[model samples]
Target chain A: MTETTGTNTRVICPKCRQELPWFALNTDTMSLCTQCGSAIRACVFPALLHTHQPDPDLPVPVAEGDASCFHHAGRKAVAACEECGRFLCALCRINRMGRNVCAACLSRQKHDGALPNLTTERILYQQIAWTLTLLPLLVFPFLAITAPIAFGYAIHAIRQPPGILPQRRWPMILAALLALAEFALGLWIIHLMLDDMA
Target chain B: MTAESPSYQPFGRSTLESSLAYRIRHRLFTGPDHLLLVRQEGYRETYRRLYFRDIQAVIVRRTVWNRIYAAWLGTFTLAILLLAAVLAVKQSPPPAALIVFLIAWIPGLGLLINAHRGPTCDTWIQSAVQSLPLKPLNRLPLANRFIAAVRQPVESAQGTLNPAALQAFATDSAAPSGRGPETSSTPATDTATIPVLPFRPYRGHAHTVLFALLLVDLAHSLFRFHSTAPVMLITGLILSIALLTSLILALSRQAGTRLPNTIQGLTWTTLVYLVLAYSFHSSLMMFRLPTWNHSSPASLLQVLYPPAGTSMITTSFLVLSALMAGLTGSMGLVQLYRRQSGHPPPPPSPP
Candidate 1:
């Protein structure tokens, strides 16, 4: 039940909040918690002793002949929103994606999915291509419809960014090849059926 | 690397995690000043950046999920094999049933792959404002490599916490710290801090009950294995319901408990074993149902426990289940006893 008391930050065990001994932290080896005895490792930096500071430069009252904020008329303007060209106070300004945007424009951009920073999920075309190419094998009848689509998608994905991380081109390449083979097999089966009917 | 450098090097291998709703692949990339975590789900990629200076600590805790996952895959693989065995025993197994035997290798290979990946762990980065889990660092080896890769840059940015300074700070609470940026606008200087609370020992009542129930289940399984009296059927049904209830209760109650690690681990293992045993028994029952006569008065008993009519494979599986239950139950009891006696088991030795 021991806890360290300080305003200054100290590295504590994530499981048990007991302050880890100096030797236990930032070591090449794992250490046990003094209280709970869980095998835990902590890599502490100088940041462990540092506290977060609130942002300064909040909006100030407008002075005589000072530029007033577009939204907050009584406050002095700090910067203009890049998207809307409106003068914004420091409080209204949102700095993201290296652009000084107003809150309204930022909200609109997030809603439209135009801000990549706000996006939490993505649909990977390469994975979709792989799924389409492979999963259809279980239901062989659907190969006729999926193979061409999979081939086209994989080809399209080759020219585009696969994802944020580097991806191997092999799956897409192999999917295209497999799709072609599957299509050929489908066509061959259809021709055999026609020959039998004749 | 300079701050202006645009190129980002890949920091770790991309790891994929799946849930019922979504599957996400996570990758780590190192920028000059920050580490980027990219989560790719379907057609989109989400990025999170943790700056070097902002990172306070990277904590990695060992977990038993890797073994549990291996066991889960093994269970499915075993189920497939058991089905194949039943088919082989039948004089006329359907031709399509042969596919079950062949496809069992998929989960078998999955089990092998999971085992090859080594142990699993949970790694989290604690900043002042938030704690974020790094899903890409779920394995110990990967987590170590990632920690090694990011250590130098972060240390370079913030400098290291030497032992003397840490000891000095540990002794005196009111001493003025000479580290980090000191500014008049710093909020920590003006804000009131919360007092630390004493830790409470979690009384794992549900876990205690669960462990005891597993022992009872083991005893019941043994007794049922030997003699299939009609009373054993009722006892078996009651034990199943009680175990189910206790498992649900134990899972819900075990969260945030300061129990010993071994006990915590045993709890999870018991859960997995329960799932495996239940699934195996259910499949066995389904396989046996086809041979039962609808009009027979002893049909229920025959399907449930068939004293003299059980196959060698079924008998072997039941014995294995009893042995596993007994092992987990006894281990849990020993750990719980040690914990209660104020002599908890020592933490696992580091590798």
Candidate 2:
């Protein structure tokens, strides 16, 4: 676990992005940002044991027995990329998903959008499911089209991971079930109409 | 900071004062590093311990009703003073009128103090995922101190005091596969980047408008504007309907949103009360029930009690309307306050 000494802690203002001393936050009421004049409410949490430090992309020494970085030949290598076996300097090495990788490999994964750790934009399947399942109810006939779609989306959501925040899976499940029921009801209505026409 | 420390210092204490029972139901103990929330419920004691490091945020929210109440009290005081002045100008002022003026000062003074103290805010501590509410703190100072105590260790532990170093550290440790480093990010930022929390914009505007209408209607009644009763009734009915519709829209728009149970209860109660009051008042007015002289009471007894000539039904409707107006007005004030307080709405329930 990484630990930083707490003697010099500062919080970034959400509004202005100005770094404010932790003590400057008013916990009782909304604190005004000196820079932006925006009201802020600070929710203080326990500090993480580990602190992140930036690595300087320095030139590698030409001395014998010194390993050079795979990406930057001039930089001294600190560790080998766990993913691709490439020697990486402190600046080129990226720790993610419990493994260290070189800049090239990290960039490749991000470009491909294959790595969950690199994912910033997410499809909110729950919102989609909710919109499909409930919104169609306003126009009762639209349920015939939307219900199946809602069910399909809800089922699809199960295989995918939830958003960055923790959430229960029950809503999706319930939505899927309700959509299925609506779809079935629509089908039954269609069958009844056919029988009446016959 | 450890749990076993004999010198555990508490920054705040919440005691449930029950006259009928000698039971200590809720107690909050804060140490240098941890907060312990204890609840005792009839032979069962439950304890929840939260370390300062794990707490993500402490949310303190206050409703506007307290300020509204204070304003109402101030108006009441002023009205009493004006009435006293009017009485003094008379050839001989009644002793009862003087007594009423003197009696009003007690509540007026109490309300002024309450207003000066500010609203009793609801406090909640947000950890990683769950938010735990402390007993609602009444005094702003006490709430501030409690928050300071909880946040101090966390702030110190996080080492956020030195921004440059922390930023450097953050950049150095940035996961290459994750989002880009924020070390060079300037203070001037766009609001678009901020995550949009679940919120109902203009959520309480309908309620506020409805309350304002109710207040206007009350004033009309007090002034005995009989000819305008129909107009007030129609306006009240329309606003009440609008209020109900807006409330439904709010609920539907933010499905599975969790508000404090007390707030939900208050909202529902005020709605029901307003509906009943409106119905009764409108009915009585339509039937042309005799109106009382609220401004000029024949005696203190007449002022305190219902007039003898008025039917019991009329009296009841009048009284109920008055009570509901006050209750709903306060509720609306609270809703308005919450809307203005700048706290992000609670996160929607997960699907």
Candidate 3:
């Protein structure tokens, strides 16, 4: 797999890491690997043709009468941080999804998970709530203990981030209604049991 | 979100792998600038972003998971139908048999759906960072659509390379270079230029041991069926333990290694056999074992070994076990010999 990123944008066979012929790449037809003869279909994009350029990190020295960096007074300001409105030098500026942000603002976004791009993982509260409501139905008696908890969880899940793509509210709504019904049934059963005891 | 920020559209969704315990789902979302891979496992979701400008290639390799899934479902459905037929012949209630027949339809429908989806495949996206599987594109049709959607944006971002340039780069990459030919190189260019290293092929010591153990078990099964002596029971127990250890060793060792196709197939066959054998034997034990209490350690011995010369089910089970072991063990040894004798191995099977 690492061989795919070989010297001059070489497209290798996925199975064997053997370099594919130029004709094998970007073709609609199936191609066979030269070494391990595994059937392969590949689409080589233009990114393979163009090499990536690393951004320059060294800051330029500040000149007289020029706007200096907020973090480093001696360095020239290249861009303003999108979040904090602070002037940032080349080294201090972190270009993320076309936004020039300072290290501090970037770290803050990462910690707060305010930016979707910065979030590596998220908990799907809606799924957890749905599972809570549905799984207890197998043992009906447990519904008395779980119904209110499920309803509460569904309400709490609404304020959290749904998912990367917007989540549908219908499933959560259905779960809440079911929980309510289960709670009512549980209350009736408890009342009947208490009456018999009395 | 800024006005200039790219808007994303849903590309495709696929269950990458699933079992009884958990399932990992992959959903691809495409934006003008990049493609996002969101993987969901239980309540947690993780993200991987592959920029169009960084994506080098999209590769699709064929796999046999589709066929394997179909076979499993078909076998399960057949077994259920057979059981239902047996119950009907025994004059079981119509509703009882009907219920069993209806249950078979679940896996029957699953088999039909699996077949309809066409062949399975493993799709990978090679980027500047590392090559990772694009699980959402697990089928050829899905991969085709994904490639079509991604190609235009990527080409527009970085200009297309002509055949002549591609060929030149292929030749240049095959040999060696200081910096890449046409494109502006990065600091990592030097590392990418390193020659491809040779990989070691797997030596099948575990496989040999497993085959040998299977043959030993086959012989032991026949011997234990003829004699009811205490020594025979002890020997049977020891053989069972050894066979189980070898099975585990062989299965684990073959994973991620380039083993011959014949050996791989044999390993899988043995796995299927073991699972079936265990299920049947455990059910039989539960049905026949007299004492359920833990207080009687002596009666528990009957659960381990079906009483010899007692029942038709025990005799038939032992016979079936011996037959399977003998056939598989012989086949394994022949395949191993063919491999050692310089015969060309068959095409590699998908894991």
- Residues A1-198 of candidate 2: C-alpha lDDT, one tens digit per residue: 011122222344432345443444444457655443334455544342132444455555535778988877877888898768988877777776557887777777655545533343456677688888888877765577889899988998776653322458998899999999888877777788789999
Candidate with the greatest TM-score versus the true structure: 3
Q: Could you give candidate 3's per-residue lDDT for residues A49-157 as a string of tens digits?
A: 6665665668999998889999999999999999899999998988987889988887776665466655678887777778888898887777888999988888777
Q: What residue runs in model 3 are displaced by over 4 Å at the alpha carbon?
A: A1-24, A32-37, A54-58, A81-84, A93-119, A132-152, A161-163, A173-198, B1-8, B16-23, B76-106, B177-180, B183-266, B291-351
Per-residue alpha-carbon lDDT of candidate 1 for residues A46-153, written as tens digits (9 for 90 to 100)? 776655556678789999999999999999998998888999988998887577889888778665545544444555677678788888888776677888988888
- Candidate 1 RMSD to the real structure: 8.4
Query: Candidate 2 lDDT, tens digit per residue, B1-351?
Result: 011222244445555745666654566766556676666554344656677666655655444446545654655575566556545665345885687579679768978787676656556665543556677354555667776665557787554434444445434433333223443342322334433343223344445555566565465444432433344545544665765665564444333233332344445555565566667655755554345445553332233323322553543345445555665566556755765585564444456
The residue pairs in collision within model 1 are: A122-B41, A122-B42, A122-B43, A122-B44, A123-B42, A123-B43, A123-B44, A124-B42, A124-B43
lDDT, candidate 3, equals 0.75
Per-model TM-score versus the true fold: 0.67, 0.41, 0.71
Question: First chain TM-score in every candidate?
Answer: 0.66, 0.59, 0.77
lDDT (0-100) at residue B157 of candidate 3? 82
Please report the candidate that would top lDDT against the real structure.
Answer: 3
- Chain B TM-scores of the candidates: 0.72, 0.51, 0.67
In Å, residue A51's CA in model 1 sits off its true spot by 4.9
Candidate 1: where is the Cα deviation over 4 Å?
A: A1-12, A16-24, A34-36, A51-123, A129-156, A161-164, A168-198, B1-12, B66-119, B167-185, B189-206, B293-299, B343-351
lDDT of 3 by residue, B1-351 (tens): 332334568886656678898889888888667888888888898987888878888888776567556656766687677667866887878998899899999999999988877777778888765787887777777788778878888888877868777776666555545435465354434434446654345577788888988898789878876776667778777877887888898888776555654577677877888788889988887786764556565546655575655764676567667777777787788878877686454444547
Candidate 3 chain B lDDT trough over 10 residues, lowest sum: B184-193
lDDT of 2 at A167: 55
lDDT of 1 at B28: 80
